[model samples]
Target: MDFPQRKIIHVDMDAFYASVEQHDHPELRGKPVCVGGGKYGVVAAASYEARKFGIRSAMPGKLALEKCPELIVIKPRFQRYKEISQQIRQIFHEYTDLVEPLSLDEAYLDVTENKKGIESANQIAREIRETIFEETGLTASAGISVNKFLAKVASDYNKPNGQKTIHPIQILEFMEELPIEKFYGIGKVTANKMHQMHIFKGSDLKKKSLEELVRIFGKSGNYYYHVVRGIHRSEVKPHRIQKSVGVEETYWENLLDEESVFKQLKLISEDLEERLRRKEIRGKSLTLKIKYRDFSVYTRSKTQEMYYENLEDFYKTAKKLWELRPFDKPVRLLGLSLSNLNTQEKKQVSVQLKIPFPELD
Candidate 1:
């Protein structure tokens, strides 16, 4: 039997941790404050106020302090954040059980068959946003799209109490002007590479043939092509324990050959594979990690549409990755892992297996 058209919603709390701080501490409201940085560390969360002053998460405490000398820095209160996350999760459960959390501050919900029987998924998202604001006093942005890729992208189209819905027909147009740098998997390095190739926006990326993109970008290019075409086939699955599981090993000697690297990585992969079997888990993403003679490190990963369960599968994925080393240095350490999980979720794997993308591939 054919199923009803699905509705997926991506919700992100506005500056979640920092916003929470502002909500509880009246003194912090409307002022620049960072929710991390106690003695010597990094910023975990930056208020919009802090962002305005060039302060951001992961900026060194020293640099963040320099950016905004008046920045009010506070240690993270995980208990409070967890409590709030549970509260928001409760809100999500009120509508659908097919909820996947990206982190403490973000989640994706599949409500095609919601308890509320709402015909319009956008309306459900809107109602959830209103409930969150009234009950939790926090603002969230919602993105609604035909698939997870577009839904995630739509969510970011607006922020801080905003919502964006992209119908399937509108998906292609919506991505045309999107900056390459802003694409979820494209990071600073890849964006620079794409810029050098005269691909600055999604339109530019779309202009390239999939084969050409594969020549330049390898496996990720296929996803890039599909994303621009708005043909992403990933789903919105129920929340689970882990999407990724991994193990790493460090060696005293810096090995210089591909054979040695693969051999060592094989050992790591074996343990990981056994664990995966024991847990009855499967994954689409595989990562091969390496540390070079100069102590520089790089990781390459590949995610297939299907999850893998065999050791040979992981080894092949790893070997392919090892062959793709563009800059080879003596290997100092190596590791392996399987991720993109859907633990006990009893739902189809979504495009989320598409993430953890920065690895060496």
Candidate 2:
């Protein structure tokens, strides 16, 4: 059976948060800048100038300054970021309704049947990039291909302010030459595991049988097989509601005791509650995720009949799960997530707030 060819484009904003800062503050442009909480907190975004000094997002602000003493640190303005993101999304909607946003800074667009009646996907990508820069004074990179996976990978091939198109004929050569680390969804640990298995590149991955890949990598083996063949069937979804909202932190020092664990959970619970309040949503299910020092992960979850929307309730559930789980080793990471969300809506008035229309016969 033959599937219809698709024209998918992946657009990624270049250093979104940092770029926004530079765009807003002329003095910060062309200088090393880091947007984050503070010296004690983690770096949320780093400008390209800072990246040259090895400063990166998620690095501690103190460490970033050490790497580049001239680095100018600024607090994140999430509301401003969201506003810019909405503007970028509006630009995406001009061409295609089929847009799947990966985050505020990037998205996948299915443009096989676009509103502009454009025949060339490459030309469409160029136009989109040009328009974004013109309207927002920001640069974006685009990758065009027949599927989501390839398009995403292609988008990163050219760094800030560039675009790449992988034609159908070029897919095979592209896949074969691609490094294992370059593939999406393959993290550092997974890449290392693949290296130990003598799978250093896409060419090596394609040589493995499906059964062998599954036995080695579990369910994800099937995904790896298909993506290497340039066959990703995931569709672009425009109105994608989040299934869960969660936050996690990797400690500078491993958490060794139950007291420390609970203290951290309490803080995380507060953060989650604030997030829920901001989103105006509640959840029936709560989950606790713990990662040991060696990178092994474990999760415990509970689902309630009624929705919960407070910090106390979340803390209670998470604490119970933590106490029940074995903790022979120190913990490197901790997270709390709420799923099965319920968004609060205004109730309809029983009595007419205004004059009602006359009943029809």
Candidate 3:
């Protein structure tokens, strides 16, 4: 019933984009700040001061302004963020090379065999957070636990310059008391579905049989079944392969007519072609993603008979897919991605077992 405890740490930067702006500009410090377009675009990142006014990333800027009249909206400086992110990453490499970046602001690190030979994961997390702040002037929160899922969940427990460690002894009690929505990877829709099934918390989810869960959630039911019992076996893959290449843009104004939509698609197609060519990869499948003004998304995909690497071919297929689907609302975002790429190689993952309840405890 017992297994080796692997130390995993999830490091999440606090308000990365907004914090960079605030750190660079002293005048913006201690004020409600967000990084994104003003007036029409969505908030890319909201500072803690802005978060106090219920402003959050991806919220429409108009709504964010209404919530905080004095909010300062700034355009994102991506290159600046990247520079800071690289500095923080160097700090991570000092401790462990088994680092998997989730984004510019977050990463998973397996410090079980860290270069520093530190024995305690909690101490490593503390040092990492402190070093990130000292070097980048940006605060980070970290979670340390026996596995990725638990470590990711624990990281959020303490926010903006805080850290938490979930020991093996606390895993069962922690999962039991956790809300279903609090479980990492369970999105809003899935959480709502679980609510309808009376699976409000981990304890409630634990009562469902594997058959019942699989019947309701399909293959994901198996995932939920295992993760809820602290059985997430997925490792920190440092060199995860790129599954798809795509580009998307959000408009300040909605495209109400098909002509405008097509123009945007053409531009996106051009970008996708350049991206694919730059990577020296070709794909058999192309996807068109449309996000309506109401924030609902719809996608259509086409698989060509042969791999394609040029704009002309993919654009034709994208346009064909667009003509096939009927739009229900004005469009705000459009994107194109190439998949089933020639660069991809098939790899099989081992099936995880359903461990007994006693194993986690």
Best by lDDT: 2
Candidate 1: where is the Cα deviation over 4 Å?
Answer: 1-5, 239-361
What pairs collide in candidate 3? none
Candidate 1 C-alpha lDDT tens digits along 98-180 = 88777788888998889998999999999999998888888999999777767787898888789999886666677898888
TM-score for every candidate vs. truth? 0.69, 0.75, 0.80
Q: Which residue window of length 10 is worst by lDDT in model 3?
A: 352-361
Model 3, runs deviating above 4 Å? 1-4, 37-39, 188-200, 252-274, 292-302, 310-331, 345-361
> Between candidates 1 and 2, which one is better according to lDDT?
2
Runs in model 2 lying further than 4 Å from the true structure: 1-4, 245-282, 285-304, 308-338, 342-361
Q: What does the lDDT come to for candidate 3?
A: 0.84
Give the lowest summed-lDDT range of ten residues in model 1: 349-358
**lDDT tens string, model 3, 248-290?**
8777678999898888888888888887766677888889888
Q: What RMSD does model 2 have?
A: 10.5
Provide the lDDT at 267 for model 1: 78
